[model samples]
Target: MGERGRDRSRGRPLPLGWDEEAVPADLGASTSRPVPGPGGDGEAASAPASHGWSRLSRRSRRLIALGAVLVLVGGLLIALPRLLGAATGPEQVTREFLQAVVDGDLETVRAHTQDARGVSTAALTAEVLTGAEDRLDSFEIRHVAVEAGTATVTAALRTGTESREGTFTLTSSEVGAFSPTVWELAPVALPELQIDLTPGVQEIEIEGVTLPVEDLLMNREEHAPRIAVQLLPGTYDISVPQVTPWTEVPQRALEVPAAFEKSEISVHDLQLVLADDARAEVQRQADAMLEDCAASTSSIPEGCPFAAWGTQEDTPGTWTLTSSPRIESLPIAAFLWTLQGAGTAEFTPAGDAEPIEVPFTVSGTAAISGQGALQVSVPAEDSEHYGYCTDAENGYITGVVVLEEPGQDFSSECA
Candidate 1:
């Protein structure tokens, strides 16, 4: 009956054990004890459970520690150089100033200057430092000696084919509590520009601003006028003003260097001459006018300086120019020009008689109209006359008449 009761108790549902105690398997030999219930007395109370760092994975803990170390290292790497630079001495400042000048850093150069009151960034150009930098292929500070708040730094400089040593002086000043001493450089003079003009040049102009010749000339000199002007560093467009009968000088733009004590520029003269294209155009118009004279059948065509005459009852003979027209003078002004040429005209009579050769001198003035066309004016004062055969009572008639001559007695010749 007892065995049956035990089996029946096992088969039945167990009661909830709120007061049970759980021990680790490694501590199985220890004494077994029952835990107090939720409403237990203070003597049997349970301690709160702990979730310490040992619960985290090993790799996760190691990664978090490495990230903190990397952050600290990166911050030091970024800030260490700036802290060291703030502690630079006067000699180091001078060396940095020279290096900045060579690199053409105008702002850094100006900042190191003793007095930058009137100096501007525009005035400190790369062109200004070109001469000095060109002379130095490479440079390094050799030695720096400081005494009584002043520092003298020696630099080893190299050129293309030469090596030299130079010294720079710096005056020390207090920057701030956290910063080291700063230095100021002495004032350096810019180069002078010498303008050498040609003998005929009387004046000079730069960028539309005219500079007086006397002001540019050197003082107490007996030679011809030459200018020596002190200029700040920059590029300038220079030219000579136009004098009468001479063309203006072409523009000459030059960059002035800061390191050079003296630089020279020579100016030349430009003269005006008649263009070949203009002369060729005038000659073409003169030849065209002479060709038109041969085609005219009037007693005297307006532009025809040489023409043949015939009787009224007979058909007019055709005239042909035997020689090419020549031009004597080219038109200088837009108004008028006189061209003179000599040509022969062949006149064919209406009958089967031989053609006669007439020698004539042609002179005419070419006027240019407002629309730029050539207007030929052949005056009557200087023209040739020729006699041609005309119909009369005689078996053959020859009449003499002056070409381009007004009110001539042609009736007597044909009678």
Candidate 2:
């Protein structure tokens, strides 16, 4: 075979017992004795990956590769450079397509694709190079050759979790450039990965960078001087940070926040109903919720905290005749950990037009030592649209409530 030799891995798994030249020399000889029992030599044994990998026994995985090799090794050398000539036909253009890839220039790579997708090669190049630094450990382009209008090349790449050895091929593109067609969207089965979570101290690893959990959680907005967590139904040991000491939470932990003592909780209602006056209808719903809160609690002027705080005016079925929209349903939560509640928000329109139905919830988690609860919820709308508590029971949001993603707030965005 005049095939170019592939570099063998340092360690390999070929059967040591098999004589390299014996099989062919004894091609027609019958050897094994018919054992009387159930088993013969049995099926071939598998060697661990660490030992070395073997080629797939199935024909499917090797079809494209085998065909490409057969055509190239025939000595009708359609050398890559000439195939990628400045004004070569599409078929001739297949040979040196992988050169652009080895050069790490996406613009040139995109131009070599068989189907340009109507997108500029420069744009395609930009997409491939984006976040590429985060994904690759090492990359090397070995050889480029073309058979017909397709190109094949050998490349070594290190994916973050593991090292993969495979051949890359270029699909013919309508443009002069050939694009790699490796993203066929197969159910890529990766090896199993496991991580253990510690209570107080968080472990963080971003690609090649690793940092502790405390550093990530540290923010002026949440200056958590101390944290205590409780992992329920206790089984695992609590490991606390020494300087920023940590402890594994058991089930429940009484959280004494950095700057606050008693954490307050409540939910706010924003409703919209169809009526003659859409604007008034929305105001009416807001007022009704506020009125109920005031009547229930004795901490408001005229027993109305909203009216006292001017969160909503103490309007009585007031009708403002204007062309505005009627909101459907809106609910938001406000939380305060150290005190009763946060301050207030100045009212603003959701958009240039009318408002739409939106659900809103905010919650917080506090850790006292090793125990902490992730609280989710329907929030109390007295002050801040902040996820400001660490109590699980009070903070956990369930049901029809809309809990925003960890770092987002619907209060202002949804208005």
Candidate 3:
């Protein structure tokens, strides 16, 4: 300690706000001067100067230079490897998956998949083959992000190398988890459906989705996963009794013009079949209906009065099977048509009913039961003159009756 410093201290502590060594050299007078005090020894007294202040001190200068170099090197280091993960990137997996597919080695592809559902890639291959008619050719992996765990594989898919291009998005099961999985396509929406007064789905359309009808799979609702498709409508070649209710729907397979309005349609056709294995029950119902038909004559307003009931002989009748569900599933029902000598009785609308073109559905559904038009008709009349008459004198009776199950054969030619 210097003499002056000891005299000023007087045994108390001298405090400092900061480390003197860290202070900038320009922030104060050079540390080389001597301070003069009372009776001071005038001769300049010097202590050893730190080699850090001398340029000729190779050790200190080199140490500073080396420390600077270390800082630069540390700043440039990349931590990408630590953040992304240690696993292989999605691109490589996809590339290998494609190669395996080309080699027809599904087992290899399955091993590389990151399916979230833990679905076997081999199983996926089988499902695709079954659903797509087994026509797989090739796919090229365009990009893969390990962080995203998603790979975009752009490839020509076909039954052969001459395939077409289809964009597919295959992603891992979760975010930040690189588990590759197969692509799941969205449901091609059906149209806005107005289930008319007929029986089942009267009409359906995709609201904003303008998918072509040709691109749709036919008989969509027939199987497990229902698809929307426009079926060919016409008088089917098969017998009504031999067809499923879905197939038995009587639709005229003509392109519905966009200009056609609902009020412009006038007729609705329908098929009648047991909703399920309930044909026996429907037969009983038919018996009851017959009783009602016989009683409807003069007693009930809706009863059908055909004189001489009780299983009268089969009179001469022409019943062409339109998608016959069975020889006996003849869905030919009777609904009285309204007519007052054509135009003699001015038949004007009586209520708020407007006509419209429509496809129809009725009598249960295709799923749990069956699908088919149990009802179809021209646009309804809003008046009392042109409606279903149940009373023989003034009403149109429209109802359904099961004539037979799927086993009856009405194919016997008339003698």
Best prediction by lDDT: 1
Q: Candidate 2 clash total?
A: 52
* lDDT per residue as tens, model 1, 1-415: 6686555422332323322333334443533334676767435544434433334455766787789999998878666654675557656666676676556676676564443232222324455444332333457789988899888777775544455566677777765554445666654344455555543233566555666555466532423345655443445666666532212245676654433123344443221122344346556666676677777654345556665544343346667778765655433222334557777778776568567677777675544332334345553245543333344453222222333565554454434
* Tens-digit per-residue lDDT, 172-226, candidate 3: 4433323323332211111111111122221222211223222332223321211
What range of 10 consecutive residues in model 2 has the weakest lDDT sum? 228-237
RMSD of 1: 27.3
lDDT of 2 by residue, 88-164 (tens): 43222322333433345545543433331211122123332342332333545556556765665555544344444
Please give the RMSD of candidate 2 to the true structure: 30.2
TM-score of 1: 0.30
Comparing 1 with 3 on TM-score, the higher-scoring candidate is 1
**lDDT for 252 (candidate 1):** 71
Q: Model 3 misses residue 176 by how many Å? A: 12
C-alpha lDDT values of all predictions: 0.52, 0.30, 0.30
| Global fold similarity of model 3 (TM-score) | 0.25
Off by over 4 Å in 1: 1-87, 110-124, 127-135, 175-179, 190-415
